[model samples]
Target: MKVRVLVSLKPGVLDPQGRAVHHALEGLGFAGVQDVRIGRTIELDLADDTNDEAIDRMCRQLLANLVIEDYSFERLGDGESA
Candidate 1:
């Protein structure tokens, strides 16, 4: 099975890296951009039976920082939904 974990900073948290990218975009002549937030994506290959609960545990324990970040996951593969 294939699983994807997306980790992102929680609202109200300062995102310096995102800000830098936003500035760079403007410098490159991109306009009308309001704000940006940087995040990460993790892909995992697992057994077909791996459940959402287990993935959620992984996200809570390691993939996301509870204080300043939030995480979500999606299962992607043949005939899978979670």
Candidate 2:
């Protein structure tokens, strides 16, 4: 099974990297941009029998920082990879 975990900073959290990118875009004459936020994607190829509970534990325990981050996951088809 292939699982993709998306981790992002929660609302009201500061994202310096995102801000920098936004600034750079404006510098390059990209207008009409309002704001920016950054996030990460984690891909895991696990055993077909892996359960949701185990995957949730992995996110809560290690993949995400509960203090400032939020995460969601999707199960990918068997043929998917990147």
Candidate 3:
């Protein structure tokens, strides 16, 4: 089985890296780019019988910083789908 985890900053968190990228895009002449926020995606290959509760625990314990970020996970088969 495959799992995908998305980690992102919570609302109201300031993202300086995202802001810098947005500015760089404007410098490169890309218009209509309103805002940008950076996040992370992690992919894991796991045993077939892994459960959602365990995945959630993994996210909370290691994948995401609960104080300032939020995360979610999706389980996939041999062919990935979310």
Measured by lDDT, the strongest candidate is: 2
Q: For candidate 1, what is the lDDT? A: 0.91
What TM-score does prediction 1 earn? 0.91
Q: Candidate 1 residues 1-82, lDDT tens each?
A: 8898999999999999999999999999999999999999998888888889999999999889899999988888676652
Sliding window of 10 residues with minimal summed lDDT for model 3: 73-82
- Stretches off by above 4 angstroms in model 1 are 79-82
Q: Predict model 2's lDDT versus the native.
A: 0.95
| Shift of residue 45 alpha carbon in model 2, Å | 0.6
Compared with the true structure, what per-residue lDDT tens digits does model 2 show for residues 1-82? 8999999999999999999999999999999989989999999988999999999999999999999999999999867772
Pairs clashing within candidate 3: none
Off by over 4 Å in 2: none
- Where model 3 places Cα greater than 4 Å from the true spot, the runs are none
Clashes of each: 0, 0, 0
**What are the models' TM-scores?**
0.91, 0.93, 0.92
**Per-candidate local distance difference test:** 0.91, 0.95, 0.90
All predictions: root-mean-square deviation over Cα? 2.8, 1.0, 1.7
